[model samples]
Target: MTVVNGYEQSDAEKKLNILNLPSLADEAKKIIPTGGYGYIVGGSEDEWTLAENTKAFNHAQIVHKALSNIDSPDLSTNFLGIDLKTPIMMAPTAAQGLAHSQGEKDTARGVAAVGGLMAQSTYSSTSIADTAAAGNGAPQLFQLYMSKDWDFNKSLLDEAKKAGVKGIILTVDATVDGYREEDIINNFQFPIPMPNLEKYSAGDGKGKGIGEIYASAAQKISEDDVRRIAEYTDLPVIVKGVQSPEDALRAIGAGAAAIYVSNHGGRQLNGGPASFDVLPAIAKAVNKRVPIIFDSGVRRGSHAFKALAAGADLVAFGRPVIYGLALGGAEGVQSVFEQIDHELEIIMQLAGTKTIADVKHAPLTHFNYAD
Candidate 1:
């Protein structure tokens, strides 16, 4: 039987027959409608950063050692006190319903099945309570976009706390929405009846929708404010979307439990450096004070390994998870996880490593970039 990305051909249907990352993305585009397809794949403006996010991974090469008696590698690790079977979490990407009918619920289920964690976006189609219920008490975090109305954000925080989310990931990069040319061209919008924000709406159609409400209500999230928010909640505060060491240091100074180094999957700030490109410096600045979680352009397990060797405590993915959801809902998401996890296991065995801790701080070199 032909094996593709660790899944056998006989098991193709069970594995979504997704083959590899490129095929998975193509299949997703084929399954989703045109507007949603564009929104899912297109990056901001020139999309240089989107391209770079993946390219930066290509520039770094993972060096593998072959002569060790490692038959099985342990992938388990602890992130902010949550025991994860693998050091992978689903990055908080909004509007999952655009990909599949079940949306965040399906993604959460898939994460739970794999014993991984997920950070739910504030713009999710489902309400926090419903999503928590659907997640069935799986370890989860709530990603926050501070609103112009302090009352609204505070109330949302209260809801997340009550819903039993383990942590709060405060996204600070997207003060304004990125110039998503595809979103404009396709006229893409989040589905109406956003369960999470329904209670906050004026109730008379005074605004366009929740998206508009979010746009108008979003206030600039400051580093100082990050500290205040951490104080407001007993749950851990993780600051996501940080791309610089200085900002990372500031987040750490502000009592952040972790620093999530990301370029918003290259969906925001088209010309910005790739998340991988900026990771080393941020890792250097962080210097183990706080755990560093990374995302952006992690399509394969090799990318995850490279990020780990370079200094990421945990690696996350957004687009691939959405692609999986688009193809076969929760099962597809599980297949994607299985593929990556399988590949990671193989890499660890071949590299003479026996665990997630063994993968970190390995010597990595760049292959094709001219300095």
Candidate 2:
């Protein structure tokens, strides 16, 4: 079979039939209504950073060793006491119900089937308990946007710990909303009840519905308050949306367990540096005191290699898994990772690496950009 992009596939229904990233993206674009796709796929106003995130990877190339006697590449890695067959994990996303009927549960099931971990968004359609049950207690992490009402965030943290979440990601990137022409043009909104407003806006969890929460946080929380919330969570806290080494150092100083470098899939503030551009600095800031995870513009498995080379302990996908879920629920989710593993295995062999640890700091070059 061939995709709309004119790429041939391995078969009709299986994931191998998806020849490339664009095919998967096309499938997702079809699954989501135009309005929703705007938010899921669109970049912020001007979209410079969104475009740069993917382009930044282009500056670097994965060098291959031709005759190193490489056998099978063990993609396995450990996260929070659980052994993951692949270092890949799904980034937290809000409102899976907006994409499919099964919602986060389907995504969780998909992650479980692949022997990977998933972080459930605070604004998820499936509540924490329901999502955990769907994965059958697979290693799951909860992503938090500090609520405007400090007590609400504390309550959420308590709930996450009670639910036995393996990790907590403090999502600190979006203090304010960025304009996506698609969201504005289509008038897209979340489907849940607006606690006090009529629109669906994604934000800090202080307001009732996502929209209001987002709008309120844009005005309420400051950097100092964020540091306080870091002191509150007992579970291993990972700070997501961290793009600068200074912020990375600050997070570590604030008692963060790990630094998750992400650009919000380029959905937030345009012209910001790509996650890769700052990964090395951030990794150094943590100085191996904690693990560092990277995300944004990771369309293929090879990008994971680049991230690993750049000192990221792990790499996560933001939209690819969502695209798969939008296409065929759990099956689609499974297919996305299958594609990743298949490509990753090939790269592992090409690079003469036998396991995730075998991937070393050697045999790579940092791409240079002329100003």
Provide the RMSD of all predictions against the true structure, rounded to 1 decimal.
Answer: 5.9, 5.8
Summarize candidate 1's per-residue lDDT along 316-361 as a digit string, tens digits. Answer: 9989888887777778788888888888888788777788988995
Q: Which residue runs does candidate 2 get wrong by more than 4 Å? A: 1-16, 192-211, 218-233, 367-371
Per-residue lDDT of candidate 2, residues 124-149 (tens digit): 76777778889997898998876566
How many clashes would you count in candidate 1? 1
Worst 10 residues of 1 by lDDT: 4-13
The prediction achieving the highest lDDT against the true structure is 1
Off by over 4 Å in 1: 1-15, 201-214, 369-371
Look at candidate 2 and tell me the lDDT of residue 228: 66
Clashing pairs in 2: 148-206, 201-211, 203-214
- Give lDDT: candidate 1, residue 8: 19
